[model samples]
Target: MIGIIGGSGVYRAEMLEDCKKEEIATPYGRVSLTVGSFDGKKIAFIARHGEKHSVPPHMVNYRAHIKAFEILGVERVIATAAVGSLRDDYVPGNIVVPDQFIDFTKKREYTFYDREAVHISMADPFCDEMRAISFKVLKDFEHKEKGTYVCIEGPRFSTRAESRMFKSFGDIIGMTLVPECQLARELGMCYLCLAMVTDYDVYGEKPVSNVDVKRVMAENIERIQRVIEQMLKELPEGRSCRCSRALEEAR
Candidate 1:
């Protein structure tokens, strides 16, 4: 089955058919998601934030959510995150399929192997096959095929100095994607992040605002939905990437 994790401004998967609410109880906590079908393919969707946007980025239960997907027998996951642009060219309303990520987040449960020392390879974090599909799907829209994401701990936007420092190496900024992406790899699930640029970071002339971010995402929500639908449809039945073999090499 394919899993879809909807971030801010995305509350539901409108394309789904015969949807039903499911509550999964994991070791970490319980996760509520929707199980539905699109084009006869099984799909499970969970809003990263609550349905009403109640959960903050830092407070999200990443482990439980991923665990729930595993329990539901999901193998591939497509997640969307609203991010602030660090570069002038990665404008608002643009989409970025991040090829890399920098974790600046603190105080989050980033792993599932707390009982053992399991060092997993993260040299290439995202699934190459999924990224290739995304690149093709994004061709009809304004997007960047490659970019680095800077994941910060928040409910708060970055300070100008912090934003500038992140800009040195990262292309986009957001509050999630650290532990969530890594945790998926631990379970050998193919994960892809479809990062949408909602506004410019504080490093830009205008300070980022919640209102503006919401406005931008609301306007571009349909674009993201379409990309996700297309990617799901294009994916082959069998996995061809190394994502599923992640744990075999971990020590």
Candidate 2:
């Protein structure tokens, strides 16, 4: 089964049919997710920031979220995030499938194996196979294929100085992807991020006057939805990648 993690303006996928809400419990905690079927395939969807958008990025229970998917028999996760563009090439209302991630987030539980001290390799954070699948679906849309995403710790947007520093290091910036991505890896689940470019950050000389969050999200909402819809339709029937085999060395 496939899992979808919704972020920002995306709280739900309208295409999901026969949707039912599920409350799941894991060793970490309990998480609520929506389950439904699309094209005869079972899918699970979770709103990362909660259904009400009440939780901030730093406060998200990353472990519980991934655990919910795991317990539900989900094999792959497609995470969507609203990000700030560090480069002009990726303007507002654009979509990017990041090939790499630099985690600047602090104070979040990054792993599940605390007692056993398991070390999962994270040299390539996002699953390449899942990313490739996402890329193939996104190719039909007007979006960037590959870029580096910098995940920061935040309920606040970056300052001008911070934005510039990030631009020097990566192509895009966002919060909430760090522990989410890392935790999924520890669970041996394939993960892919569909980062939606929502703003230029404070680095842009536009004075940061009127970057309307609602407006930007409204403008790109349909395109983002479309990409995910296409991705669901094209998702492979069985795992042909190493993501499902990630836990072979866990013991």
Q: What lDDT does the true structure give each of the candidates? A: 0.93, 0.85
lDDT of 1: 0.93
Query: Candidate 1's residue-wise lDDT over 224-247, tens digit each?
Result: 999999998999989999998998
Query: What is the clash count for each candidate, in the order shown?
Result: 0, 0
RMSD (Å) per prediction: 0.7, 1.6
Quote the positional error of residue 162 for candidate 2 in Å. Answer: 1.4
Q: What are the runs in model 1 whose C-alpha is more than 4 Å off? A: none
State the RMSD for candidate 2.
1.6
Clashing pairs in 1: none
Clashing pairs in 2: none
lDDT tens string, model 2, 1-251? 88999998889987899999989998889998899999898999999988888999999999999988988998889889888889989988778888888999978998888889687777778888777877788776778888899999987778788888899989988888898887888888999899988888788776332355556877888888888888888887987878776778766
Error of 1 at 99 (Å): 0.5
